[model samples]
Target: MRRGLKISLVTLTGAALTLSASACGGKKAETGGGGDDKKTLKVGLAFDIGGRGDQSFNDSAAAGLDRVKKDLNIQTEEISAKPDEPDADKESRLRLLATKGYNPIIGVGFAYTNSINKVAKAFPNTKFLVVDADQCKVEGTNVLGACFSEEQGSFLVGAAAALKSKTGTIGFIGGVNVPLIHKFQAGYEAGAKAAKPGIKVLPAKYLTEPPNFDGFKNPALGTEAAKGQLDKNADVIYHAAGGAGIGVINTVGAAKKLAIGVDSDQYNLPAVAPVKEQILTSMVKRVDLSVFDFVESVSKGTFQAGTKKYDLSNDGVGYATSGGKVDDIKAKLDQFKADIVSGKIKVPTK
Candidate 1:
């Protein structure tokens, strides 16, 4: 738990994580919160650069927690990522949540991997869940990792993009160029090629370096990238760029360009509510479902530990149901979805 991210944008480093076989192993204790009928569970969430309401991964996680609150009648606390200080604010949020007695704390995205790992050491008794990070060790079996096979979903989305594009040109934008992001890119490329042999995809990264994943927080960059793609006659654009994807949505709205949403249901999240008109469909990853599933496991005595991956085979990661446009490619899109679901098609994870 003493590990820290030396580099600005590097993901959670293994050196920063210290896990012992018996970290989360001990006697089973009874749960007592406020000792009341409500049984209040104060859950904490540390969002990524996109923060909450990004209409993407962060929003999805929040939505999951929201469901937990509704179903379990628990209270929730949240923290936003700061531009000035990264880990300190993240760590402070987690620590404060722990000190305030938020039993189950959840950190959204890989950005919190460092803070969560370090904080996990400080607060051994409190359970935590971290998405997009695998560097931390679970203490007393109280932590969970929420990951996704984004490539699998992106592959299906890519095929849909290729088949649906009347212009025969498509575009893709990623918030960061991490290994996970690369998986989306590789899948998009392969799927597009598979669908249309000579199709051309305009791929652009929000930034050339990893130092600014928060660049996903900047809508201006997303707008510019979308405009660039639209100008090139890309009828449909698929974006995996966190909050930056919101900018893409905005630009698509103004330009009347078709945009493919990512993570959560863009049509449902606040960030995309303003631009629902231009969103063709979204690439859905059940990050929210995974997060809730993790917490529910703790409640059910089946908490899983280690690097668990949620791939298409497990219904953990896949494309979102096409909005009103699912019928636009109805027969074909249905086949693709079923193919992946029924093993008729294997979406590559590379």
Candidate 2:
């Protein structure tokens, strides 16, 4: 379900030879236009730390690029960010794509907020999209922010966890202690409390603090965090960690406990095949839809600059029931979703 008001696309000028970097790699799709057409509409994506193989956040964004390649038949370039890389590297990545004539370049995570702002200003004609960041909301800028109501989705999954918890105790694992991930923590706690007033939600465990984003990519950290929670008798655990959440799912599955995923549907991901049955549900954040819609807008000459919010009202975020584990509780979850959408329930973001 695409949602947005279409407007005319802005024309961009200039193009340069492609460049490569040691910290990041590029994957170019040859589906769209070729040659030196100034209006080729090439899409560029700068992925977060975990990149495409995480089967999580980055992969969700990749799904959108894949759709653009297939449906729009447009050329696209993808670049992955290295863990803990300096902010300067992000700017360089975006600039490289812009120089290579990739219009409507997308910075996939909040980490690229500053980089996108700086680079978008330099390439005034090139349109830019930054995901998960609201700071890119500068007036008259070429950058458009694609932000999500992650708390709304997390709240639904938290309620699911509480309803399914046999021990009346659930846990949450976050990749980093940043405010973005905090939204997941806050909503999860709130929903769990709302669903089961006496349910015990262990203190949210963070794999790492600020600056050490390895928590988003390190499976070992996720495994360790899940172990601690399970040792405390947590029968169900939900993680907002990126690639690391894979470890949490695997560990919880092996222990015969339930695990919840984030971003994409983990139960359907081949990467998590061994423990798919253990995944109760996932907070499905529609990064894929957002990315695809933005690129489609650019290609169709209807690109708009500013922030677009994806939330329950628009079906932008929700929980996945891929394993039939949450089927019995779907009605309750939908009711909660309705309440949230109707303003009867306010899920906290902090």
Candidate 3:
């Protein structure tokens, strides 16, 4: 249930900042220093287009940072921008953090690719962690990127969905149509196909580009999309649309059909609570794991600069157990999980 964040990349400008990775989840406490030291590992975040508290990607990443701040008693500064915000505004936020000496500023999605590239290059000495990065570089002082094997996770989710579906129809709703989101759709479709052979997996996106990830931030729109899918006779729907997915889940709530989640455990989020039992399950992408992993590395003085990818191979992403409603189908779901984890089965992307 780890490694679900996608890596977004950008320019060659390097900046100066420290990267602090947490060792565990949600607010670790502070420990006394051995020397006369007030070492503050200040970390900054550039949230995905949906911003924070969407019960998804941004939230998962924040969960990890929040853990580090609480448990390690380290100073933390967080800034969340709206999905509709301009690129320049996002860049300005990054710049402001840099000026304030936030080290190892992390950009949560590909949308911040250019902003991170420019920021990192401008402050060459600052280290950056771009989750779901695209081979981004800031010259010498930076380590690299980190990513997840979404395909593997998506496959497992698809398989599980298929195993539980009784209507032979399912749906996938994505925030945008980028390769990252597309991969989720592809894997889901493949899984459904695998389980039922002829199962119908409908794939849709809220945006085409530019505001791709923004699609997830609009609840009204998400609800409308889910309603449409349900009307098409799909009893189950999976959402990879940041905040938009919540909207989709809400629609499923009203319609009484089943829904699936992505990024984090929706069962833990208030927005999706009403439909908790109906949430079938989630395709968990452990953004929190990656964030805290980085923090732990930083705490141990083992922090490095560069890109790190987490996938099924590295337990970066996987499926959530049923919201407990699909007990009748757990056997198939468990088998799917085992096959994927043991490499005996592979979920296709293409």
Candidate 4:
């Protein structure tokens, strides 16, 4: 819990964050009274690419915030990210929240690694949670690292694809080609191979790389990648792309093929309700659960530092069974889950 980011610190203010929030999504007014002894908790969130409504990662974090806001009577503020926003902007956003006296500010993705590290050092009292990024290495009683075993979840979905695929061929699409996304691809490929020995797993394609991270948002790139895989006779495809996953699902449905979704349950998403049946399953990374856990701890004054690893054993990451598309293979999938949890199956990280 004592890791640190080596970047220099920067100061941010409430006015700056208010303006940014307004420019991105209309800001929500803080509801609690401005008093030192107020019972209301002040919470802040800085969302990654695709923000709240991309029907994916950011939305999952928002779900946690929304639930706590209602259940705990807390005052909350949220901000979204612009494509290619520099690290300085992320630091400013975090600083804005902490400077305004919000406790336990959470950054929604790994992109906030550097900023969180630098900012956590400056504001030693406010809690900071970084989801999906372990490299931030922020160590202190106030910083929490909420990371997931994405590969473990992806492996489950990949097994489903293999079990259900009539074509013995499948594909994978990733948002970026970093170690993080590579973990997704490796686990997926391993799961498919484990389920169906010698199955033809197509080479994974990435939408973009760092400094050009639109791969997480642009559905067009997802569609193009999925189409290529489908053209190669891939009947089932799994994607670890964030918002871009919308296009992957659409293309799969149009071609009457099967798909595996990431982050939130795509089948349950209202935006993709019409094509829900097309999604056989989703690698449900429980960002909501993690966020809620942090919120509860802070509220109870039990805030702790260090990384909380969400793996198959903790039910932190798993494949969704909505739509009953994978019902026939449920028992088999359960066996895989058990084996993974028991450590008999060591899921590859990269």
What is the TM-score of each predicted model, taking all chains together? 0.80, 0.88, 0.82, 0.88
Choose 1 or 2, whichever is better by TM-score: 2
Candidate number that wins on lDDT, 2 or 3 = 2
Question: What number of clashing residue pairs does each candidate have, in the order they appear?
Answer: 7, 2, 62, 3
For residue 69, model 4's alpha carbon misses the true position, in angstroms, by: 0.9
Tens-digit per-residue lDDT, 1-350, candidate 1: 11111222222221121111122444434331222222234566667665666656777787888887666555556666665466787887777777666666788777777787788778766777888774333333456676777777787778888887888888888876676677788778777787788888985555435676655666778888888889898888888887778888878777766788888667665556677877777878888887787656555445555546777778777666646765666566657667767877776655
Q: Is candidate 2 or candidate 3 better by TM-score?
A: 2
Ranking by lDDT: 2, 4, 3, 1
lDDT of 2 by residue, 1-350 (tens): 11111111121234332322112334543322222223446678888887878889988998898898877776667767777989998887788777767777899999888888888888888888888875425333577899899999999999999999999999999999998999999999999998999999999999999889989988899999999999999999999999888889999999999999999888877667888899999999999999998877765556677899999899889889787999999999999999999999999999
Worst 10 residues of 4 by lDDT: 1-10
**Cα lDDT of model 3 overall?**
0.70
- Candidate 1: worst-modelled 10 consecutive residues by lDDT: 13-22
Cα lDDT of model 3 by residue, 1-350, tens digit = 22223223222123333333344444422321112123446676677765556678888888888887777666565666664767797788788776666665778776676677777778765667777775333333453466777777777678777777778888888777677777788788877777788787865644436554457676776788888889888888888887778888878867888888898878657777777777887889988888777755655656677667787757788777746765666677667767777888877655
**lDDT (Cα) of model 1:** 0.69
Misplaced by over 4 Å in model 3 are 1-39, 135-143, 203-208, 326-331, 341-344
- Tell me how far candidate 3 lies from the true structure as C-alpha RMSD in angstroms: 7.0
lDDT for each candidate structure: 0.69, 0.83, 0.70, 0.81
Query: Which candidate wins on lDDT?
Result: 2
- Per-residue error for 288 in candidate 2, Å, reads 0.5
In terms of lDDT, model 2 sits at 0.83
Which window of 10 residues has the lowest lDDT sum in candidate 2? 1-10
Better structure of 2 and 4 per lDDT:
2
